[model samples]
Target: MATSSICRRRSLSPRRHLTTSPASFILLPLFSKKRTMWCYQNDRCKDNFKKSFRLLKGCASERLSALVVVLLLAIVSYTLYEVQYKTGIEIVPFLPIDDSGFETYNEKLLNDVVTSKAAQNQLPRGSLMCWVMTTSIYHKTRVNAVNSTWLPRCDSSHILTNSPRFLDDQIPYHTVFNSLPESYYKLFWKTRLALLYVYQNVSSEFDWYFKADDDTYVIVDNLRKYLARFDPEKPYFIGYRLKRRMPNNGYNAGGSGYAMSRAAMRIFAEKLFHDKSLCPYHEWEDYAIARCLASMNIYPLDSRDELGRQRFLPWRPEQHFHADLTPSFLMDPIQFWGPSIFHENLVSMHHLKPDEMRLIDGLLYGVSQGIWKPQKAPNSSTSLVNSTEASPMEDTIQPPTVSF
Candidate 1:
């Protein structure tokens, strides 16, 4: 048993010897060196990778910042360019030359008076002529004549026509004319007043009613011919438009040569009677007229050449229409008075001198086919009709008389 025990111990001792030997220890040391080298290399590589990632992140941030800045600047620059493109051009104003008060015989009143007297003198056979005067009054005789023969005379007594209650409070600059309460109102009143007169009285007159200002010349034959062109069944307003810059909401600051239409009269009357509140006071006459028509869905036709201008004449043989007429004294010396000058057939003319009646009458009779020479002035021997007082003709010459 001792021998068997000794053999077992020997076996265990050999195993132990193998485990504790210097050669084995040296091999273990070599394995430890290899592991340390691998660990060191791994640590260095990890550090380098972390450094590279940090660099890449910084570069991306900088690039993004620069791109954002460029975009912001571009957006700001584009907004300023559009603001400077809208406020450059403007419109002109219409300022009448003769805006004086009438102390003596208002030509407008005289015309009405004479028309009434002539109508009465000729009794059921004479034609009645009506005239409209802006910024002036007429004689009593003329007023009577207008009442008796011309139908109605419309005058704005410098009274301002106010906007409706709801509109007045809502509109901007409503109280701007407090000092001259009616000043702003007068601008629109003259035109509207005339329109009202026509609406109430002259819807159906002898044959036709001519609309013109004191400073205009009306060629009766030419007007007759022009009137003939329009079918009374489908009446249209006729006039010359003052070419102005568009997109302007303000007044059309110029003369509207003249407009005539049976439909215009009735339509305007209906509109005014029905929706008087819709009519706003405007300083521009033409614009007001346009507004009145627009309310009724009636627009002007593009017939511009019917009226004559200082630069161009009408194409028709008998010069029947003209605008912007000035007195000979106010005109340039180089200008010439042609056959179309105010005469017997003159529907209207502007700026005639008080003493020029003789000259005007002579011209009228002289141009007659047999009365006198076309160039000859009339003789004083002819019976002269003076409409100075409140004669029956005076009533006829009141405001609203049709003049052309």
Candidate 2:
């Protein structure tokens, strides 16, 4: 009985110890609060770090992209600038060299020509007169030939003068030595003369001007008549169409005839004067003209008939006309010589031989006589001749056959 009582007391003592422990309750609540606070702080720090990392990454990407774009734009701009400023070099003969020095005759001539001369020179009304300037070597054979044949046939009013020569005897040794490929030196002299002519004379006297080779044959009347049909108020540059596939560097099949408007001439002349270094010394005159025109946004015009045939195609022998050789008949010939029929009627016919001239004259006389003598109704063949007035396609008519 005594052992049992001791065990019961021990059990009751354990129950008493549980009921009296207040320190355990306080310490548990404090520990739980501290744990929850630590967890909350750690989560806040993690979220803030993630947001800062994303913002930094976004800023860095945008900056890198902007830098790349700027670099690319800078490279393209520099390349284009270089191309515009670069000048090409070549070799050609210089002009206007005299015993004293470079001939100042061109300057004198330009100064002498007043604005009144241009207005009264039989040029078309409200149209620009362009004087194409060229200098020949003036050798005895060439001068005599030009004087006797070309000048008379073309009926040029300007006189031939020996004011310039294209030799380099007067140039210093250092200049010759520094100018390698020698051809470039000659070309430089020629270009300089041409530019000087433009600066001193062409800009003031004419609305536009062309510089070309002496061998080129121009039907001035035809050119003038054609251009007369178009409105001249807008910016325009016309030249023969070239059929090559390459870009601007190929040979121009259109020959050397190039046209520019008054605006283009003024702009080009101004730019060339200030930036003389931009001129390239080259053999291809047409290319040089084209490049210059392109800088000012000018282009060449295409030549096509109403039926879509090229105007300059090889001529068939079957097509000929009596009136084709006469001036009062077709208006298309006016494109070249402005308002002057003298050039087309008299001068152009001079190139033909005596026999050819006689044939044309006889045809005109016969046609005139036939029309005057005949009395025909509207249905008759003779009336057809009268009905056919001057037309643009007059050059395409077949002529009557005559046995020699």
| lDDT score, candidate 1 | 0.37
1-404 per-residue lDDT for model 2 (tens digits) = 34334334534664332222222233435557764345346755445445434544554575688799999988976555444323232121232111121232123434433232312332232344433223333323333222222332221222212232431222100111121123422433344444454434433344444332333333444555555665554445665345232234322222334445556566555664334235333333445545555555665555434433333311111121212323322213423322232222221222333234344444444454463332423443345455764333443334444322
For all candidates in order, the CA lDDT equals 0.37, 0.38
Off by over 4 Å in 1: 1-129, 134-185, 202-208, 245-257, 273-278, 302-361, 367-370, 373-404
- Models, CA RMSD each: 29.0, 28.1
Q: In candidate 1, what residue range of length 10 has the lowest lDDT sum?
A: 155-164
| Deviation in Å, model 1, residue 201 alpha carbon | 3.0
lDDT of 1 by residue, 120-162 (tens): 2222211322344332132222222222321222211111112
Query: For every model in order, what is the number of clashing pairs?
Result: 40, 23
Question: Top model by TM-score, which number?
Answer: 1
